[model samples]
Target chain A: MEGNIYKKLLEELELGNKAVMITVMDDKECGEKNCNRKILYTEDNIANSCISDLNKVVYEKAKQSLETGNLEFVQVNETESYLIEPYFPEPRLIVFGGGHIAKPLVEFGARAGFLVTVIDDRPSFANTARFPGAEKVICESFDKCFDLINLNRSTFVVIVTRGHRHDMECLREVLKHDTAYVGMIGSKRRVKGAMEQLVNEGYSKKKLDKVNAPIGIEIGAVTPDEIAFSIIAQVIKYRRLADGKEEKKILSKVNWPEIDRDVLMELCEEDSLPKAIITIISTKGSVPRKAGAKMLVWSNGKVSGSIGGGCSEGEVIVKSRYLLRDREYEVHRVDMTAEVAEEEGMVCGGIMDVFLEPFWN
Target chain B: MEGNIYKKLLEELELGNKAVMITVMDDKECGEKNCNRKILYTEDNIANSCISDLNKVVYEKAKQSLETGNLEFVQVNETESYLIEPYFPEPRLIVFGGGHIAKPLVEFGARAGFLVTVIDDRPSFANTARFPGAEKVICESFDKCFDLINLNRSTFVVIVTRGHRHDMECLREVLKHDTAYVGMIGSKRRVKGAMEQLVNEGYSKKKLDKVNAPIGIEIGAVTPDEIAFSIIAQVIKYRRLADGKEEKKILSKVNWPEIDRDVLMELCEEDSLPKAIITIISTKGSVPRKAGAKMLVWSNGKVSGSIGGGCSEGEVIVKSRYLLRDREYEVHRVDMTAEVAEEEGMVCGGIMDVFLEPFWN
Candidate 1:
């Protein structure tokens, strides 16, 4: 039943639809069997409900969270609390060149959690060897490659092609897609020329003006790596800082690798090994991992994923093993408060509330 | 003879000594054989001299450059010009704990060209699997592990152990090393307590003030990765921004991966292959690679390293093939000046003076 909820949420994300995943945070008045229950709600309907009773209060909270794109821990009453998180499809980054700059750009882009795609007319430049971090590398002509890439509203386009002709071709096609960002790398003179040409070709000046010409923040970058760093920094600033004001919503919560798919898949498997799922429901101060980080602790002490990966994580694993044997849910508080931390062998001076739920298939 | 010069230079760098590598930039009055001829000059003596006639003028220039620690392209005369580059051992980043933050710290440190070493008492925490980017991972007690790591005056140390006890132990040992930078991860209260303890134990307040307590820059960082980024950014600022003023000289120049060891080792090998070495002696504006970027192109169209690696590099490769057969040197001018770049299929709006010389080894 839990697997079905996650499966439905993943499917909703895959379809470029918005969703709200509500996970019960506390056992409280609920029975041990109802502990850590979850519900997936989309715009159309309740995609999957792991909880037996989908209360009106929980449904209202999910709906409010979905509208505001907020992550909220809502306390309905003395007995119930839910962690409601709005989910959207991951943002996309499309590079129109796989040259020296593109190599580092793809690395920084992927590291920043954008699903990166590299496109170049030359196969040698547009190969996995050059851009190993890129999700897709398409060797296609510059003007005709738009059909190959998923140019959605949430996509960020960077044109760093070999010549002006290719840059113009990419810019023309990209303008029609209403991408979140369109940055073209070139000198001031080259950018001016490209803009003038596009304007003369009947493209609106206002649209052309929106492009991040000479792409990248002014960090006085000299090398390709530094330039790539500057560009990615600007991309992040745009995605995060322009939160509600921008038309393109900042989709996908959390950094890449924070959402451990392998652990989730293990949880989703049928009748798999007996394990305990540890989720950091809340955190305060300087913790290694934030709230929502999950880890899978098996019966034999083997583990997948991480909730900090230090003495704190080791403590969670120790607690999880006992919880797995008991086959119940427990909200364990991990105290790394500096004064007591040394005695407890914990480091990061923070406190975490972890929800440890025993699982079998 | 040229290979001997590079071999001796590498040896000096490996030994943590300072030296200067001077390469003749132009082939004017000097014969073709003298073009790109280099010399390795250490404090003791000239280690290797590829140029048969090392004039008094060049030696004086190298000595002056060594004193100022400057990278200079000096025009000795209308007939002779040389690019003088000082070589020092790579900066070392010693992370005291191979915990969650250390995972990203090693990566950022390595990327910033710091040779990183991670140490932890736990065998599970201190391993290659946890830190693939680190140069060394020593699994030993915090207090007893100093002998294993080379904590020289140029080393940057970060204390982030499993507890305050380990953090203090590491700090005590690290304080004796005269490291370039020392940072400790903790909350304000913990850092204050540790500092007070160290002061009571007889460490001077003047000395203790140097530590970057509460670690990282104030960027409102929360996650381990963000904190790691913040810490590494501070390290880089300490390195690149504080050049010349500090006692610990900013020694090794250029970013990591910019100096391709494979190409350099190949260049130093005895009659290994017939190839041409292309070095970007100077660049202006937004080019991919900076001055000193070297690439070796073989007769079989195989290439090692890169001088930008785009249309500009492709052009150089074609030029290198011609120069290889001719067995001569050419100071080729690559103009990617924006107006002319599009016509030539180049993108980066910069001009580069590349010294392409044929080699048989």
Candidate 2:
């Protein structure tokens, strides 16, 4: 039954659909035998849910969780709570220039888990050699690029062409589309001149104001790489924090934890039996990875993915090895406080409540 | 004589000496045929100089330029001006712990032109495979790493070890030396606890106050790559703008413009002759590169370095080709304003006064 639920999740995720996977952490008050039961919530319906009676309450919380894109533990009743993990497709970052700044921008954007696309009129600059991390590199003119890529609410656009005319052209075309982010790189005077030109071209002041001109946060970035860093930082802020009606799609994890895919697929295939799953259900302060981050520990001490790699993870893996031997399910608290560091050598800087479930069937 | 001067400059730079290269922009008011004369200022004396008559004034201005680390046009008289460009050795970035965050931090620090070194206790994590950008990677305990590397006023230390104890240990050792910047990655509570422990061990609060605890700028960086970007941005701010006595070494150009080295070496070897040297002497508004950025355009249209690449540079190259045939030295202005972009194809958004000189000897 757990394998079937995970298989449904993998299929939904593969289809580029948003999903909320709810796991009952404690079911002391629930009448149904729903403790450790997994329920998958899609946009329209629920699947593989054992707790049909609690679907109304669970649906409300899942909807809110999807809206906020937060992985958290929500109280259901007197003593029961559920871990809600929201998953969304990777955001698309379309850079409209393959210049100096665009190179690092592509690298950083891809590293931050944005599916990056580089579009430039020059074939020399817009090639796979230049942007190895970019998912697509289109050597086409600025005006012609609009027809090539899909622009939607989850798409981010950055204009960093060599000339102001090219910048304006890209801006004009990008402004017509619905995008999660739009940033153009230029000097303050250049930004003003370009904005004025757009305003003269009948672009509304309110619409043009949404463009992140002189793109990037004010970290006093002077170099091309620093500018790229600033731009991607701003992009991440919008991806994670922006909650506007127009930009409601939020992604909690930049790069999806590999273990979530690899181990879950292994569970679906009935191979790699006796694997212990460790998911961070809740985190206090300054943890490495956030809640919903998962890792799979095998019987032979091999592991996949990370929950803030270091001594704390080592301690958890040690306990998970023991859990795989005797326990079917357990809620373990990993403490990374100074007191713990002094006593048992746990080195992280926060506290995390993790759900450990062993699958041996 | 010009080749000899360039050779001397290269020698000084190779030896990692701070130098101020002064170029006379105009000699209309100055005597001694000082127009286009080159002067090199070291700490104690001047070398390869033809403007001995104006040494006192030039020396005074050169001293100020070295201290401020600014490339600017200094007026010597009513009509004559000099371009003061300062050069310093690469700053050293010593990263303790070759962990996940350390990977991107090393990449960013190295990309920002810092000589990076990564140290870790675990040999598996401390290797070239993990940190290819790092100049050196050492597999040694944090307590013993202080003896392996040199730490001075130009050194920036970043502590990102796996554990709080390691963070505290690295901090204690790092504080013993004088460094330009010191940043430690940890939670606010962990930092507070570590600082308190250091204070208990007789370290001054003022000294501890200087450390960039919870490292990186407040851009709300969540991922490791974003965190690395924020930290590198702060590092660049210190390297380019910090004006403290302890952090006096300022570097304007992150990566030494490749054209500066490759063409200067060509000049040193007398291999690239009949080359037109374009040096940005002054800038008005927002320019791609700052003053003192150079580009060498040859008679064959081959080039080295850049003065802000694109259509503006292309225009300069065309002008430089004309200059190589019929001109000795000319002061040309490349304007990237909207008015100029509308009239001509000059696409940048700023103004730069470039001194073009043909080196044909």
Top candidate on lDDT is 2
- Badly placed stretches (over 4 Å) of model 1 are A1-70, A76-83, A104-112, A128-132, A151-158, A164-361, B1-71, B76-83, B129-132, B151-154, B168-361
lDDT per residue as tens, model 1, B1-361: 5346778877776654557778765554545343456767875575354435666677776765554445566676676777776655577899998888898889877876788999998888898998999999999988789778877545788888877778888888888766667999999898999899999999989778888899965444445765675676566655543332254444443222234567778777876567888878788877877776789999889998988766778999999999888777677888777533452234448898887877664
Q: Candidate 1's error at A130, in angstroms?
A: 4.6
The total number of steric clashes, by the backbone 3 Å criterion, in model 2 comes to 1
Candidate 1: residue A11 Cα off by (Å)? 8.8
Among all candidates shown, the one with the greatest TM-score? 2
Q: After best superposition, candidate 1 residue B110: deviation in angstroms?
A: 3.7
DockQ-derived CAPRI band for the predicted complex in model 1:
incorrect
Q: How far in Å is the alpha carbon of B337 misplaced in model 2?
A: 18
lDDT of 1 at A166: 81
Instruction: Write one digit per residue (lDDT tens) for candidate 2, span B258-289.
Output: 22566567666656467888888778876777
* Runs in model 2 lying further than 4 Å from the true structure: A1-64, A67-83, A140-144, A176-178, A196-209, A241-361, B1-64, B67-83, B139-144, B176-178, B197-207, B220-222, B243-361
For the record, the alpha-carbon RMSD of candidate 1 to the native fold, in angstroms, is 10.6
Cα error, residue A63 of model 1, in Å, equals: 9.8
Worst 10 residues of 2 chain A by lDDT: A339-348
For candidate 1, give the lDDT.
0.72
